[model samples]
Target: MPNSKPRANSLIELHKPKRASSVALVVPLKDASRECLKRLARYECPSLPPYPKSQAAAVLVGLFVGRWGDIYVLLSRRSATLSSYAGDTALPGGRWDKTDASLEDTAASFAETARFIQIGLPIDKRRVPLLCTLPPFLARSHLIVTPVVVLVTDPTLRPILNAPEVDTLFSHPLASFLHDRAPFPLPSSSPYHDMPWGPTRVRLHSFLTGREASGTKPIAGLTASILLEVAQIGYGIAPEGFEADAPGQASRRERIAWELSRAERFVEALKREGIRYDWTKEERREREKRLGRDKSRL
Candidate 1:
């Protein structure tokens, strides 16, 4: 029989991307702290109207990239049947439990859940160091979400997913997110005027870039707020504008450029009205067609 350690190493070796100037960062568990939980607990809700309060935890899982010289975040589409935030793109995490001792414990629980869904890659838990936690974000359902940032090493630990909670998992390269062409403009009719961009995208944007949006949308709410904190820690600057074209619109540079120019003003219009969106709900619904599962647990 093959040696387990050697076999594991071999499997890891197969998926490792070639060395570049920027490599994915992995922090050791010993260096990780659960202090972010305190900030999460104390975070004040954004200016939006308040809702009932519940507590939840999520992990801002990231990988180091050689080309971008920074960490990239991992995002996933939630199953449509969940009680809340159905079919939205988000980080992996769920409600806190009474048995959990701390945010780290809650994170571990999700990691295990990821494993159960077969999305748990053999992450070197020890090497994945905890960075910091963002302030808690308030969801529409009043779920106060605590986001924990962790750096992962070991390229061999490819994601294995459970289809029920996660429809698909994708990585947003820091470079792409930081690229000038990547920002999405806010719409005018959005319900979240103070935060033109919805919370999740805003959080992802903020984590990728440090600065917050200059417009009325202040990157409020749970996901966006947490992303803002992550961006501050990582890049220290936010991208100036939305991506030039719809994510899947066209591959041509000219087309992308035209779309970006048009989107800049449209985004402003959205900001004026407090609408924050890149794609319409219809777009999200259409994408759901490609995702196989419909049911999820809260």
Candidate 2:
């Protein structure tokens, strides 16, 4: 969606720099899209056009000022009872129902509902922070998911999980995802190979935020890809001489290296924070065992 929302009036200083007491994150509504586009301009990322034919869905990339004055993104763990992607970590989102006029509206509605449930503060439409839509990604279910990035200013609010859809919710510093990590190489032939847009297969990266320590799960699939792209641009870590071109046969290795370098930076950052590189195979096996036992009891 375009950043043409009317500027916040005197009652709320939505565009001003945040003060400790202020509970809302604000930026000049006009600069919202401009800032997002500016950040993404360095890389040859392709923006998805309106996909009326595809089922439109959107995820909320909710950003908020943390207790320590750090900027963090709100994430949630799905309940195991769900039929699809059960117990997976995700951003708040769902299909664009008839009630939503556009994908952006769909994202805004979900964000408002989720934030209200997580935190006690009722969302004021006028105070909604800068929002910009990012490139769409394809989900495992084949739905085209759009990510709406929003900046949240309030720090007093805390998560109160909506247990049916979300088992729990947590916030991770936006900077943490920006740290270097290793790219998760994909098999040569994958679902992403036939994309109608940019690179068919850019090496995927891993962001191992300290989720396990807090009992929160890791984010994977399309959600992880979107976050990585957002982190690269939002945190200004894109490499020099980056071009927005389809990954060519000859330049494939170079492209992979480029993606890996960015990830390596995130890996180093995680080290500094004392977070493990990746979830251990033993941990995965233990979790699977627990799940198996829980199922047997049921």
Candidate 3:
């Protein structure tokens, strides 16, 4: 008859030989294997931008990636009471000053703006990495802007906004902009005040898209073009058709177009203030070149 009762330790020992306690036990072997597989499957590519000439003026391009794994780009809506780009959406950066040790330092200074505005937000100053600097860009204000790229890991960090400099804070998810079906048409008129692809947009685009895109429409300026470039990178798409604009080739009209599309309210406000603006032939040629057009007329 088969035995029904449970076997004692002695009975189990009789069936198997005891191993030395010195034998190491391997635990979570499957988990370790999975980790190895993940590591083997993942790859990284270095993205670098050409360095711009040493300049007094510069801009900061802050990028934030949330816990949900979604990337969100931050921009500021200037107060209507300010002089330039008033009430328009722009990046949280400005011209570099003598006190700034480096472009990275200048970009990080934005944290002070947050403090002044009493937003009670803190930025992890350590995470700001200087990716690369593009050729210096001359804005309508005759200021050459050196754009710097930075990554923000903590999105919940509240920002202390400068009441006079920044009126409101805005953010847009990268996923929303990447959708192929979304209608991201260029604005019918100028969006912002004087900026076509405002500093924020331009920097964001450069980081997103490795190269620039051209042609007259809303999303034609450097900023939008850069965003498109970044999207291409995230999707691992080859930037075959994208072009890189030459320095001083961006046009004032293109800047105007970008501003109009991005923030019509700000543009209207500037017009109400009777600000003078114009687009010249040379400016158009320069802009076209910056949009990646060559000397050959297209």
Candidate 4:
């Protein structure tokens, strides 16, 4: 009798990957990619390509076209073993080392980042061009994460998880972030205002994804925010329900400036607010616990 066994890659095989047939089919994606580049170019100034006062970081936003003309973006769940931002969805880059002779050399150092994202796909440089970058975001760890968008035209690609840095690799519809209702199959919601970062807050989104029934943790926080801007520009539309920024919210550049210029004052205020210099999110946890306790009164 012949043995009948399921393949080890059975889970990945279950979901049909979206692919493009020809150049004509990818026009929507190409057009959107061009739109992102054009919109970002408008903000070009001397102060741009914002390098953080803290350690410089970056996240690669990989965009590609699917079969039916929808734009998709690459995302990954951070490894559970990670010390920070673990379980959250994220882009495929990280804190780039800035210890170099010149800013140009610093850019050269980022060539090393390919090692971080060199998963089983065997990315071809000809097909994947590192193109425009979106505005920088100031992370809780004090790193200024520049959002770099890249267009992937190659359809003959399959990605495997780069364990340690990533737990699972997934793709989400890039344009869906601009929609009021998230087009995810799994349960999803927008702007879950659970926590406030110091005095400011950003629009947070969450989606349940992956093969599991319960769903992954969430695509919330910085990752979601980055995609929102991408979708807004890429599709030339604003998010439906909520405004992008709250009133009096300090821009990421402004926040970074304050952090750098008033290092002593910032540290003291953060410490008083339980945002330790070590960057522990103590206030967030405490707020959750307090909310839980308050619910008991009802």
Candidate 5:
């Protein structure tokens, strides 16, 4: 009866992600690949060893699209002038600082994703998301590092590097690492001699990207292992370190505990050396407190 007709109903539709097209695709097989990484099952690394509490670190697993709709991962060559790991290829990340809230924050800062967006890359900024955090891996420097995975929704983004920490940036397709063959006649010596549990042998896979040669140094250490886990999810392959009909594999909690036990041994060694680490001592106190509480409750 009112002068104006009844207001039209506002339709509410459930949010459904659409697949990205070839033109200006931010990442290859966008929606499907993202969902695969998001819902990835546990990665099995039965032989992965624990790390010490004295050093904590984080690295960013930043992914984007290449010219031909292939997915590429951002990697950096560390600056030659650095005190450690100079001129080595690595993910853009560093030691966890006091200002950071978590390892995730450390990765986000190093990636500079926001700066890339502000520079006018054609992408839906809101579409970017943290896929998931992978379990901690032991670095060659005796630092325990957690890999923080992030999706970059801009194909044309160029990451800004900190000259002291990072020298240059490069990318490689993820498919190349899906299945890797052991290098011919492994090197006699590696810097990972300090690795917990007697220096386990990790398979190193080599691949070429951009203008680099196939003979380029293969990504090794924790970096290689982390990529292998991600490749497993992207390609829908079975987790590494597991054989068909193997008796059993380590659970997520068990894997974490393994690292903690190794950390305790590191603490003992540090005490013997008369070296004091504030973080390690703090963690030990906290662990003791938790154990006391558990015993009281029991």
Candidate 6:
């Protein structure tokens, strides 16, 4: 039998992801906090006027300065033991608990579990401070997810690996999301399908990041979508060549607004609005064509 520690190290070497040679950045280490604060300061996060606490969800966008001064966002691979979305890459967060005073609190509390347990990061409030929340995003599950941005200040943090809920912890370059040119090795090779979401088609992206620092997995779906927005917001710039968002499209706030204006619950609203947030036959075929393959999940 092989030693587990050495086996793990060998796996990391086997899957090391391609490093981006040069990624344009407006959020360098020194300015990561300043730039994010400045950008978010100008914009107001819109409230979902209709949903109650039971319907709210949140995700923590934990950012830290890497050893080389580039800005990175923390991610985790859900433990395969989970019933749903198991083994998928996700930002640390979950549905809002009744005890949570606000979505930001829900995001922060979950983040503490993910960061501290996964990496042995200390419980010091000074190390991880919630910056602000972004506009709410409707998850495929129909619950609205609010991304709470936080900056990790300590650089010398060590690995702890005690996470029972997470199989691995990894970081991705925040700025790489802005470019369509495959800034981080995988390029657009990540399988994707432009699924119909209403009047327009939105891309359902699946990025294979290879074996990254700590542990890594493919990032896709709403998680990928959220990071794209975060990268744009943190840097105060749109994606380089492609549109991060469709031009003149109704803002996500506006999309959610349509639900509030109606009496329908979010799930019902998607059905009533002729919106296909999940893949239908249209997307299934496209995905197969794109990937030349696939699977089924519960």
Candidate 6 has its poorest 10 consecutive residues by lDDT at 7-16
Per residue, candidate 1 scores C-alpha lDDT tens digits across 1-298 of 1111111111112121321123344332110111222232233322221111123445555543322233356666667777876766567766766566655556544443443342464444434434344444544442445565555555556777777787767665433433334243233223132222321122223222222232122222344434545543454445445432222322122222222224454335345545454434433443353232322211
Candidate 5 global lDDT: 0.49
In the range 1-298, model 3's lDDT, one tens digit per residue, is 1112322121111111221112121112122222222221132223212122132355544555443333455655557788766655555455555566665555435443432232334444333322333334444454435444444433345667778777666565543334322233223232223322443233222222111142111233334544444444433433332333333334434554344334545345446645444323434544655656534544
Predictions in order: lDDT: 0.41, 0.51, 0.40, 0.55, 0.49, 0.59
- Backbone atom clashes (below 3 Å) for every candidate: 33, 12, 26, 0, 0, 1
Alpha carbon lDDT of residue 285, candidate 3? 48
Task: Report the candidate with higher lDDT, 1 versus 4.
Answer: 4
In Å, residue 40's CA in model 1 sits off its true spot by 16
lDDT of 2: 0.51
Q: What is the C-alpha RMSD of each candidate to the true structure, in Å?
A: 18.6, 17.9, 18.1, 12.8, 12.5, 13.6
Better of 3 and 6 by lDDT: 6
- In terms of lDDT, the best-performing candidate is 6
Candidates 4 and 5 compared by lDDT, better number:
4
lDDT of 2 by residue, 171-278 (tens): 765544543333322212221322332223343433454556665555555676677667667556552222222233212222222222234443353455454433
Tens-digit lDDT track of model 6 for 1-298 = 1111211111111111221122222222334434544464344565444454566777778777665555678888888888888888897666777677765566556555543455455554445544556778877676787887766655566656555777878888877776654556433544456666553456665555656554566678889888888777777787665655443344565445444434357546556545544423433444444333223321
How many Å off is the CA of 29 in candidate 1? 21
| lDDT score, candidate 4, position 112 | 33
Off by over 4 Å in 5: 1-54, 101-128, 180-216, 238-298
